[model samples]
Target: MIRDMAKGLNFPEEATAFLGECFDKITALEDGNDQLALAMDAFFASKDYASILNRLAEQTGIHRYSVDMVFLLLCADSLHDIYYIKELPEELFHNTMMDLKCKLLECKALHGIWGTFVTDWLQGYFHLKRYALGRLQYNTIEFPYEDYKGILKKGDRVLSCHIPSGAPLLIEDVLDSLKQAYAFYPDELRDGVLPITCHSWLLYAPHYEVFPEHSNLRKFYDLFTVIDNEATEGSNLDRIFNVTETDDYSTLAETTTLQKRFKKYLMDGNVMGEGFGILLFDGEKIL
Candidate 1:
């Protein structure tokens, strides 16, 4: 019973419809004979990915703490479904899903200043806007504060917004600078690429900032190539570090697929690895 499934996982009554829908889809798989990997393939192959991600972000109200877990569970199900040939039983299947859900509630998705600031500010800004305004209205303006707002507003109005004591720092300022150029290019980024880029920047930016003595953003310089070809040397940090530098779609596709496959492999472990091996061996045999 999915009710048991939800109760076992401590999921709220609000998730009843959502979890029921997921369970219904999983149960619909060939009347209990379908394997886990196939079910996941079917799930991901369908519109579930966008739906679940959208729920993780908006409906579930768990973006801050539960999102990483949802992401992990998403790939986990996908990889396991792609690798495991065995059909999961109702109990185990429900249990695994519940465990994944519970695990998500415990996962730490944020890593850098973005993580810290988003937790304190972004969530607060969205959840408690009036409170944030009360705090930020009369303090010294921060870098990314002025920067990100401009991008979000699509205007270049310099803010005199003051930061209150113990206020969140302007992590979005750096993100804003990066946003200026990539305004709406990668639709995914505009949609739900927050974690990817936030994690990337969190890993890179601090070293470039406070401890310039100990870090080098240039370590990642070659990763991106300017598509314009006229990109100059040392024009600006953001432009210099643009990921869209290259004009090669193949390179971009390969890079993206490689990252996706690797992430799948990492999340799903030997399941994905063995699946790949079987695919390779089967292809060789057919050849």
Candidate 2:
């Protein structure tokens, strides 16, 4: 089951077991103190994420923020709960599950999924975050929106046809939609370079004895194979860049496509903060 999921994330087959082992090892080390060790998890689980975050911030003297550690570990611990994809076809199920789990595990998962919910938004108005000298806007695009005969008003009426993503959404699909927006606003997207990011839930493998922060690590370093290399262009080619397996990313990270794809992340705001990076292509590449 895990192998299938790891495969979907384009993760290595071997590391799936190793990651499970890591979780088990963490669990074993926790021993009888699991509850105490996971106190932060309890706080966040009870919707006190903000309060705990504040408290942890004030305690600068403390090293090794156990609260934060527990939160992410809890995320890892719960990575396998995929009720949404359970009924999907076997071939389609694992990838879907991995995609969703990865999203849920991402550090900024909540804000990236929905806007930073706690921010003040009066009269149905809210400000979105941005990145890269305003070159990148964070999670500001609603998958379904106006100017393309979008509903214009939020209501029951559906337009643009909704589809259940039984797998991770494709970069090509994202680009297609982005182009639609580009068609509407040409001046803003001047020079054909529009950089939007896509991220997935992935617990990366070790890098120089360090894990790359264990979140969505896709810079789509391999996407050029599809976008630049015509032979690779197709329906799910974007997913070929999914770093699902642990060591899979580390190996794929070092490839002919490395320059074509970047083994990197934004200094900030590729999405909310961190742990949400997949494909954030530059304008020249797509347009």
Candidate 3:
């Protein structure tokens, strides 16, 4: 099952085999082990995932993140059952589950391992509160801004769109994802329009200074009506550069053009921050 899921998520053959080995070890360790059994139960019950994860690491002598991957694979059956009960499309489920492989790649890039630190974030998938629709991920969120309410009021149902890593945020793909969100959540639409909100560093206005006119990031930033910008202590350096730490910016790699530009931007005493924006999509297009 782990191998099948790994393949479904397009995991490399080496990663697939390693995950299978972890699964086998975990299965063998589960029988007649009361403590291990308790931890597994707690994991499935959504009780203290960190503690369960730590316990698994101690018991199995495996890296915490590798255990995390195995645990996610263990929960695959239940997640599938939830998707089935919700009657969501299989493609949607696959796209959402693809986040696992994405995060694994991120872990490999950052730490040279096949694991994830965002197991808590993955809970939304198991709970059915999030979906991946093409180039974006959407989670149901109440309109969080009260200070500048226009068409959307506080506590109103809104889809919070997130730009997941691993893809160029092309305009066409983003538009298609918005269209899918409009069709997927008929109940959440207001007057045939889907209200979407985003809060991410990509929307940070200052990034435009470094982004070229035709850069995809800049293009995506222009899609929303930004309402707020706030200073952040640290930037998304880890995400942007695939490095685990950002304390010493001098060590950051400049593999991509954006990376080179952003490194210079940071070195020149500029700060990275986040912005909040809203978009109203009227089924066919953004209104």
Candidate with maximal lDDT: 3
Each candidate's number of clashing pairs is 8, 9, 0
Model 2 Cα shift for residue 17 (angstroms): 4.8
TM-score winner between candidates 1 and 2 = 2
* TM-score for each predicted model, relative to the true structure: 0.21, 0.28, 0.93
lDDT of 1 by residue, 148-181 (tens): 3122222322222222222233434323323421
Candidate number with greatest TM-score: 3
Error of model 1, residue 248, in angstroms: 41
Alpha-carbon runs more than 4 Å astray in model 2: 1-14, 30-92, 100-147, 153-287
Candidate 1 whole-model C-alpha lDDT, 0 to 1: 0.29
Writing each residue's lDDT as its tens digit, candidate 3 over 55-157 gives 7677777788888887787576668877888797788889999999888888888888887878888878777888899899999887877744466778877
Worst 10 residues of 2 by lDDT: 122-131
The residue pairs found clashing in candidate 1 are 37-81, 139-162, 139-163, 144-173, 225-245, 225-246, 226-245, 227-245
- lDDT for model 3 comes to 0.81
Model 2 Cα lDDT, one tens digit per residue, 54-172: 34424432212223332333442233333233442333223223333333233133222211122211101111122111111123343222222221222322112111223333545
Misplaced by over 4 Å in model 1 are 1-42, 49-78, 81-211, 214-216, 222-287
Whole-model lDDT per candidate: 0.29, 0.30, 0.81
